[model samples]
Target: MQEFFMDYGLWLLVGLLVIIALVFLLSGRRKAEQPIEPAVSAEAAPPPAPVPFVDPIIAAPVAAASVVAEPVVVEPVAPAEPVVEPVVEAPEPAPAAPAPAPVEPAPAPVAVVPAVAVVADGEDDLLRLKGVGPKLKALLIDLGITRYAQIAAWNDADIATIDAKLGSFKGRPVRDQWVDQAKYLAAGDIAGFEAKYGKV
Candidate 1:
């Protein structure tokens, strides 16, 4: 330690001397800084060279953008319930009205009433002829004759047999008025025969 002190003592003295000279020089330079003249005044610092104002050139497209909106797609929804409707049927039209009943016309008036011929019950019409009696009347009716005109048409031989069979018609007038009346009725002269025989 004694050796290091002895060896640096001279160098320390020199550094101190140099430090004192630098202090003096710095003081002189600070005094000289006031000697430099300001020709105009404090405002003479040329207003920081006016920043050359240049407007930005931004280019934009002439046509406007086509702001097309996308179409909205809605998903189809399934039905949640089943619906049933009642059936309606049209009614049948009323039937056509029935036609009125037709009126029946009155029957035509009768002009004349005809007279009907009525033979007496059990009185033999064949008995009015000659040789015809109860027995002959029965036989004549059996032979399909119940009237005097039918008996009068019988020939004389037929009358004779029937008379002989009856045993007593001996004087028969079969060829007289009976035959004449029969001929008249056969000739469609019933009115004349009825007039002569008193309306049988």
Candidate 2:
């Protein structure tokens, strides 16, 4: 049913509208050209002439002829046939259908990258993070990770991505609490650093 409607919906709608319009047009003309008020009986006795409604619209020529005008006899055609005025009526409008709602597409996913900060001295000292030594510092620098703030900002995804590249350093960030140390180092909070993880 759905497939049939999908293929022929437009044509069916058009055909229905055409049929409706034709009906209205034919009805209008039929009403306009109705048969005169059921033809008056020809052999029956005729009604009296000079009726007010029939007199004015149909004119009083019969009354005038019946009056003392000329001596000529004007046969009474008074009720020969009934008078009819066809009425034309306006076509009623069809109801309109509501439109369908619009659809919005979903947004695509974006990759999350950790931010790296550079200072006037060059870059933050990754060594300050207790677990990151000179070799790890060099490796971090090579991997474009030069800021303590960057390490502090490592989410699970960032940690996973960097760990995948770190090889031997995998899981080191979590094991040594690098993010906690980096937070203190990034903020230059020496007192806080010593309070938590000993001297800087």
Candidate 3:
């Protein structure tokens, strides 16, 4: 009995130590799982009455500016008198002279002449005539003489008139013997024309 009590007492002591350790660990777990209540202050002072937030940038209140008014006295002004200027009389202008009568232009002197008869056949190629070029042909056509017969039959007065009318070609008729060449051409005398002048 004594030996059994000694050996089993040591085992009971170790078992009791294990049970106490388990009880302490479970109690700590339970305490950690439970929700905790907030602690209350003794005199909360109503949260310090929520101190109004003031901006550091705002300036402190100052006394309002004072405005002083003074009385204004206006004096009455006197009325000014009007000044009169002397009037000058201008002399009347003399009557204007009557406009002179307009002078009439003199009547132009006109000469009567026979009208040029237009031939039924068109103008001939006077360029084929000796000393006759495009320019001379145009001048002859303007002078109403486009045919060889017209130039061949020109009288002294007609020649004089044509010679007078010729501006830059004044001496061409007499110098080039246009009448003789024209007469040969009018007669269709190619041989005579070639003999008198160069090749037709």
**lDDT of each prediction vs. the true structure?**
0.58, 0.81, 0.78
- List TM-scores for all candidates, in order: 0.26, 0.43, 0.41
- Ranked by TM-score, top first: 2, 3, 1
Please list the residue runs of candidate 3 whose C-alpha ends up more than 4 Å from where it truly belongs after superposition.
Answer: 1-119
Clashing pairs in model 3?
none
* Poorest 10 consecutive residues by lDDT, candidate 2: 107-116
lDDT of 2 by residue, 145-193 (tens): 8888888888887787777777888889888998889888888898999
Taking all chains together, the TM-score of candidate 2 against the true structure is: 0.43
Error of 3 at 32 (Å): 99
Q: How well is each residue in 59-120 modelled by candidate 1, as lDDT tens digits?
A: 22322235556899999998888777787878988998998899899765432212222467
Which candidate comes out best when scored by lDDT?
A: 2
Best-to-worst order by lDDT is: 2, 3, 1
Report the CA-based lDDT of candidate 2 relative to the real structure.
0.81
Better of 1 and 2 by lDDT: 2
Tens digits of per-residue lDDT for model 3, 20-51: 99999999999999999778799655655567
The RMSD of every model to the true structure, in order and in angstroms, is: 35.5, 35.8, 20.8
Candidate 1 residue pairs in clash (backbone atoms < 3 Å): none
> Model 3 scores what on Cα lDDT?
0.78
Residue ranges of candidate 2 with Cα displaced over 4 Å: 1-113
